[model samples]
Target: MRDEYYGRLLVQRYQLLEIAGKGSMGQVYQAKDTLLGGVIVAVNFLSRSKMNQRVRDRFMREATISALLGEKSIHIVKVRDYGVDEEEMPFYVMEYLKGDSLKEAMQNQPMPLPKFFSFMRQICLGLQCAHDGIEIDGNVTQVVHRDIKPSNIIIIKDATLGELVKVLDFGIALLKSDESPTGFMGTPAYCSPEQMDGKALDNRADIYSLGIMMFQMLTAELPLKPKTSSFDGWFQSHHYQKPKLFSEVRAKLDLPQALMDIVNRCMAKTAEQRPNSVTEVLKVLEQIEQNSAPLTTQSQSYTANTPPTVEAICLQSIWPKDKPRAEIVFPQLIQYRETEIATMWIMLSRSDIEKYRNNKPHSQFLFVGSPHPMLLWLTTLYQDEQQHRMLPCYLDLKKPIGEKILQILNQTGSYRLILFALEGDERCVCTIEGKVPTRKMQLLKEWLLESQNTGANHGQIKESKRSLKEELDTLKPKLVASLQRQISKKH
Candidate 1:
C-alpha cells in the first residue's frame, strides 16, 4: 500500500517528498519549500491519532524551544516555521541537514582525540545555551533535555569550523518551571540516578547522562550494564551499581588522566557530585586539549605526541593594590604566528575563583539599554593571551545569583580595568589605572536597572558586542591621555 501523505503539500508551502523518519510523537518528512524556490527542509507533524491536549502541548513547546534556542546558538537545530495543516495537525519545518548521527558514527569506531574534543565542546555549548534559560512569561527558565544520547546529536562536515554538531529532539525536554511528569522518560543506559527514580532534576542530571555517553564513545561499551533491559533493571543499576573504570573497560586504551577524571565526575551517581554547569566542563576540556597528547593504543604508542601548553601571561606585579579582592580585566597583546593581536584577559579573586572549582561559575550577561544595545558577560578563568572561550548566559537581574555578583562588586568597592593597543610596538604601550569610587555605587545601581530593562534581542547579541567595541574604541584615547598626565607628574 502507498503512503497517504507522501505526495501531499503542507500549508500549501511544503511539498512532502518522502518519509525521513518517525518517532513516538510524530513523523518527519523530507519536504521542499515551494515558496522558497524548492529549497529542501524537514517537516515534522504531530500524529493526528494521538492529538490530545498533553501531546499537543509537548509538540508545540518543542518547536518553540527549538526556535528560541537555535537563534541563540548554532549548535542547536534551527526551526524555520511552525503551524497547523488543513487537518488541524500541528507541524514545524527545520533546516534540512546532511550529516550522520553520532550513534551511526560511533558504530564505525571511537573518534580521534582532536575530533572528540571539537565534537564534545560543540555539544556542551548547545547544552549550556539551553541551561542558560530562555525568557517565557516574563521569567528566564532553564531547559533540561530529558533525553540526551548519541542518536540525537548530528555531526556535519563544515568547511570553516570543521565538524559542526546540532543537538535535536526537544520533545521530552523539561523546562525548569514545568511541573514534574510521572514515570521514567529517557534511554535507560544514559539516564541519571535521579532520572531513573523519576525525581526532581537539574542540569547535573544531564551531566550524568553525558558522562555515560562519553564513556561509550571511547570504550564502545557502557560503564554499567543491567541484567535486564527493563525499567527496574536500569533503576537498580543506576542507583546501586558503580560505573566501571576506563581501564576496566579497555586495559590497553592509553588516555589522559584528566579526560578520565572528567568522565568519572560527570557520571557521578548523585547530581551534586557532578559538574554544576557545561561551561565548567568546557573550561576543563579547553585545558585538556591544549595540554594533553592524543590517545593511542599500545601498538601505536611510538607515534604519540604531546601538544605544547599555552604560556600563562602573569600580571601579579601590576595588579591594583586597593582592589586586592576584586577581578581585573585587561586587553593583552599576543604574538600569533606573524602578527600581534589583542585578546581579553581576566585575573580572578579567591571568591570569584571558587565558582569554577566544581564547574559552577557566576558567569552571566549584563545588557545595556537603548541609545545603544550592549551586554557584558564576565569570563572567570582566562587561559591565554589569545583565543577566548565565550560562554554566554542571560541571568535574571532580580535573582539571587545576579544580586550576589553585584553585591560582591560593590563590597570590593573597585576593580582594575586595563587598556592596550594591539597594533603598537610595545605590549603595554600605556597602563591606565582607575577605580569605581564608593560615591559612584549609586551610578552602578542605575546601570544594573538599565541592563535589566534592556530588551534581550537574542539575534542581535553579536551586533551588541560590536556596539560595545565601538564604545571601548571611544574610551581608549581618554585613558591613554590620563596615563600621559600621570607620567608627567612622576617626571
Candidate 2:
C-alpha cells in the first residue's frame, strides 16, 4: 500500500489487486477481484514498519470480526477477505466508499441545519445499528463507532440517495475498549470521558461524540476548548465544569432548549447519567424539532427504534459445539484453524478412546491426497493446535493408495471408518481390503463438491434465513394492522 497509495497496484493475486488512499489510519488500497470481474473493493492495510505483532494480529482479527459481522447488503462498507501479502504484511478487503469523507464535504459542500441533521441522523441510525445489532455469530457484537468524527463519516453521492448517509470506518476505529491494553479509545477532541479513560464504555460514548459533532457542525467550533491534548502531556478534561451551552455559543442561533438539553446531556459527565438510550435521544431531538420551526428534511421513514431483523444462525445462534468430541488418532491436515483441526483430531482421538463404545462403531476416514496447500496448512494446524499424536498420514489417493487404505481399515475392522480423499472419486476407486462405502462415499463426495462449488453450508443456510427474516419483517407491521382491524370489528 505504500508505493501504490491511490492508483498503483502494490500486490497482485489470482483475482485480487491493491491500490491506496489517504486516511486516518494511513493509506488505504482499493483491491480488485479480477476473477469476479468488475467487482472492485477497497483494502485497508496497516503499513509495514509501523505494524508490530499485536497491531498486526488485531488488524487481521478485525477483518475476521468484520467478516463475521455478516451484515451483508447493508449500506455500510462491506469487509470481504483477510490475508497476508507476499511480504507477509497483513491486509483485508472491503467495499470501496465511492465518495470522500464528511470532512471533505464540510469544506466543499456545506448544508443548512435541517439538511445536515438529516445526514447526521442517518449516521446516528448506523450507530444505533452497532448498539442493538445482531451479527453472523447470532450474538450481539455491539459496534460502537469509537471514532465518529466528520472525517470518518461519509455522505456518498450514490445511485441510491436513501443509502447516502453512511458511517465509514466500520471496523478498527473505536476498538480501544477495556478488552485491550491500549485504553486510549479514539481521537482526543471527539472521544468521550469513559472512552478516554478506558472505562467499560458502550453506545453512550458514541452519543457523547455525536453531541460534540452536532455542536461543531452548527457552531464551526468544537464544544470544548481546542485541545492539543497529546501536547497537554496526556489526559484531557471532559467539559464538566459549566461548559458554555449551545445557546451561549451562538446566541442568535439559540438552539431550542430541548435540543440544547439533549446535546448537554449527551456530553454528560457520567455515562450512566446520560440519556436513557440513543432511541431516547432521538425522541428528544424529534420533540425539539416539533416545538421549533420545521427543519429542511425531517425524515420519518427510518427512526432509531425501528426494529431489526435478528437472525438465528449468527454466531450467537448456538454456543460452540466444542464439548469434547470423539477422539480418534489420525494424521492431521495443515492450513486449518484450531477448531477445524480439532474436529478431525478429536474425532480420531475419540475413535481410539471409544474403540468399542458402541456395537456399530463410528467411521475411520482415509485421508488420501497430493497435499493441496489448504490440506497442508490444515495438517500443520492440526499438529500445532490439537497437539495430537505426531504421526500424520500424507498419501496420494492413487490406485495403490486406495488399496493401502483398504488394507488398514480391513485389518482393524474399522470399515465404519470415514474416508477423506482429496480426489474423492474414480481417481482412487474403493479397492479396499473388504467392502467399500460406495453409497456413503458418494454422499460424502457430493457434500464436499457442494462446499467447494457453493460455499460453507452454514453460510448458505444463513443467507436463506436472512432472506426469510427480511420477508417476515416486511409483513410484521401489515399483520399487526390486520389483527388490529379484526379486533376493532369484533369490539
The alpha-carbon deviation from the true structure for residue 464 of candidate 2, after best TM-score superposition, in angstroms, is: 20
Instruction: Identify the runs in model 2 with alpha carbons over 4 angstroms from their true place.
Output: 1-26, 68-75, 108-111, 133-138, 170-181, 226-234, 239-241, 290-491
lDDT values for all models: 0.66, 0.48
Candidate 1 regions with alpha-carbon error over 4 angstroms: 293-491
In terms of lDDT, model 2 sits at: 0.48
Residue 310's C-alpha lDDT in candidate 2?
Answer: 15
The alpha-carbon RMSD values of the candidates against the true structure, listed in the order shown, are 12.9, 21.9
Instruction: Compose the digit string of candidate 1's lDDT tens values, residues 339-422.
Output: 222233344333433333233122322445544344354432222223122333233333223333344344554332222222
Residue-wise C-alpha lDDT for candidate 2, range 1-491, written one tens digit per residue: 33424443435642434544654443476666554444566777776666798777666656665554434213355576777767777777776667767676666332356656556556655666566654534545566667778887776653213326666665454432337435665777787777777666678888888878877776666678734556232245563444456666676775566666777788787787788667677656644444443212212232334421111001011111322222322321111111011112223333332332222222323221211101110111111122222212222221122233333333333222222222222111111111334554553354333323332222133344444445545654554454345545756
User: What is the C-alpha local distance difference test score of candidate 1?
Assistant: 0.66
